[model samples]
Target: MSKEITSRKDDYSQWYNDLIIKGGLADYSAVRGCMVIKPYGYALWENMRDVLDKMFKDTGHQNAYFPLFVPKSLFEKEEENAEGFAKECAVVTHYRLKVNPDKKGALMVDPESKLEEELIIRPTSEAIIWNTYKGWIQSYRDLPLLINQWANVVRWEMRTRLFLRTAEFLWQEGHTAHATAEEAVAETKQMLEVYADFAETYMAMPVIKGVKSANERFAGALDTYCIEAMMQDGKALQAGTSHFLGQNFAKAFDVKFSDKENKLDYVWATSWGVSTRLIGALVMAHSDDDGLILPPKLAPIQVVIVPIFKGEEQKKAIDEKVSVLVKELKQAGVKVKYDDSDNARPGWKFAEYELKGVPLRIGIGARDIQNNVVEVARRDTREKKSYPMEGLADSLVNLLNDIQQSIYNKAFNFREEHITPAETWDEFVKLLDEKAGFISAHWDGTGETEDKIKELTKATIRCIPLNNTKEEGKCILTGQPSNQRVLFARAY
Candidate 1:
């Protein structure tokens, strides 16, 4: 490797920071808590968005846009949500900037231009979206209005990382209105499964599908379903969340629909979202100390062909072979890049692409061209194999798929190995401090115990496994009788 990254074992956070900048993904912006996602990073986001947008459309959701700023009055309508997000909101008090009369070469907020009510930049679109849904949903026929919006949201965070917890990030929030509670809950879980499938199949990150506890639920939601993925550092990241909002938003906004009998009732609601945070999850889940290791399905450039030459004749010959190979790969629906740039050496190109996480790399040198073979390298394992040009396209496709499956399997196995069941409080605390993965411990099903555990260990109950067994035991902390074990981990 020409340039090495901060090893994950040395410092997990440092490794993540190094990977994002070194991999050509993103960089910190001038603004505090914000980032500038570069072309490669944006391309990865586009791929994720395109696939998810299709999934939503196929499932009967239509795209819509909502205002970025919410009136403070409208935001306060939902008391619980307002309280939950109050500390993290960016408020605009004035609309104009004026030249500072007391200072040279400076501008400041015009005190005279302050509005009657402050505008809160949306941390989420629920308030503004629900207020608009009030008018669109006046009858039973409009009860199930499925809408999704792809937008950037701002959350004023005290500390920020690139995609994980940036002040501004891109995400898709799906807000739907349903007539019945059962239908709304079902929609919530359905979208959770969609996120899980996308993460596992496309991003090659395995996730656990479960429900959030009351204390961990979405601000205004009745219940929250989530897909939690374990990062390589053994910390849990909530990859995505689907909220069964019940009638909270509708009630807050007075959004009502008439039933078959002509009785007016509030609409049941569901809101689900997956953000650029998934990009962070992808980085930590499979990337190695070498650099990023993008899954083939989501890699912006799935395969790159680097042609090597020592002379003009050799260059001509290699270019000819590369052109043919590129055509074949394109015909097979593979995204291929032929890198014959004279500015960079073969060794430099190899290190660059490895950092950028290209799944497959093909090197065609003068000697290899003579042998009618090209050296192919796998990003995941760094395994190199020389294969004859014949049937190379088909082999590349298979190898890409194999790499995808291999990454998922590796993550799945690692997650399984890290999940340790603890029967005693000492063991539970010890595991949280030492191993630090998913700790399955009986919780007496009390929010007080949950809060105490979180206070002491900085670990929350991530979820109660979907099909958890009813094993009679004592609460790891409270000593109260418990029926089942819940997964507890310090999460991102």
Candidate 2:
């Protein structure tokens, strides 16, 4: 291989950095905190988008578009949201730029050109979207307006990672309005379930479905539900979130609808989204020392065929055989690629395909063809076996399905094993410092306790898991009366 990958053991962060760059997925851009997603990375995103789009459509959601910029006046209407995102917002203060008088081939912000009101590049589309929804709803008949938008958003983060915390990233936000608070809350949890299902089944990443604590909740939201996933390095990533905005945005934007009984009431709202940061979660969850090990369902190219040869005659023979296999696999509904490039040897191609995370690879040589058998390698387990050419297509289809399930099961098991329940402050602190995974502990249900825990350990209450039973006990830190246990972890 091209210099063995930085072992995950040596440095998990460095390993991820090297893999993203050397695997031909993405590159850092000229702009700080931004990245250029290459063809390979974009293809993977396309696969994710396609699958998510279908799920949204199947659930009675319609696609729509919203403006990219939110005027200062509109943004400030929701004070809580504005304050929450202000620290990370990109603002457009000037309208134009002109050539610098003292410098050659340089431009400067024109002093003469300034916008009437500075526009805040959206970290999320709530303010602008709610303002627009005000005009669309005048009566209860307009209730439950479920809409989703696929778009790019900008956030001026202090630190950025390739896919996790980039300044600009792609995501689909679902903004829905309902007539009743109950309906809106139900919509929020339902969407959370959707995200969990997508993560576990499609991405092959197991997640814990739960509700965020008040301190960890989305700003201006009554409740926030999330799907939290664990990475191989024992860190946690919030895979997706769904928030129930109970009359917050509606009151901010003056979105009121008249009921059938002539009563005017504010609309109830819910907003949920899963961003491209999911790509990072996928990498950290399943990748190994060699390279990425993508789930078969999410892999852009499910299979790659490498033809081995020493001469023109052997090349001709392998090409013919590959052509037949390609046609058969395609007909069987498999995403397959025939790589006959003479620029690289079979061994080199093997490592290349593995780095790209193609789930299955087929290798054919003159002897193998003569024997009516071909060697197949799996990316997940790095296992190779020879199989007869007759039923090769069927075998590959089955193996891909198996890989997808196996990855999910492995992650699920890891998550199950790391959940530790603590009853004392010392134990909790020790778990946060040494274990570095999810810690379940009793809380007094006060924001003060949550904030103090974060101040002391830099660990936050990730969530209060769904269906948690209430048990009378003392708080882990305060030794005060408490009712239930909440999940804690240092999150991404």
Choose the strongest candidate by TM-score. Answer: 1
Q: Which 10 successive residues of model 2 have the least lDDT summed?
A: 1-10
The TM-score between candidate 1 and the true structure equals 0.98
Q: Any residue pairs clashing in model 2, and if so which?
A: none
Residues 1-492, model 2: lDDT tens digits? 384689998998999987888777899999999999999899989999999999999989999999999999998899999899999999999999999999999999998899889999989999999999999999999888999999999999999999999999999999999999999999999899999999999999988889998888888899999999988877889999999999999999999999999899999999999999999999889888889889999888999999988899999999889889999999998999999988889889999998888899998999899999999998988899999998999999999999999988888888888889999999988887788579989988899988998899888888888978988989998889988888888888
Candidate lDDT values, in order = 0.93, 0.91
Q: TM-score of every model?
A: 0.98, 0.98
What value does the lDDT take at residue 489 in candidate 1?
94
Best by lDDT: 1
- Poorest lDDT segment (10 consecutive residues) of candidate 1: 1-10
lDDT of candidate 1 at residue 19, scale 0 to 100: 93
RMSD of each: 1.1, 1.2
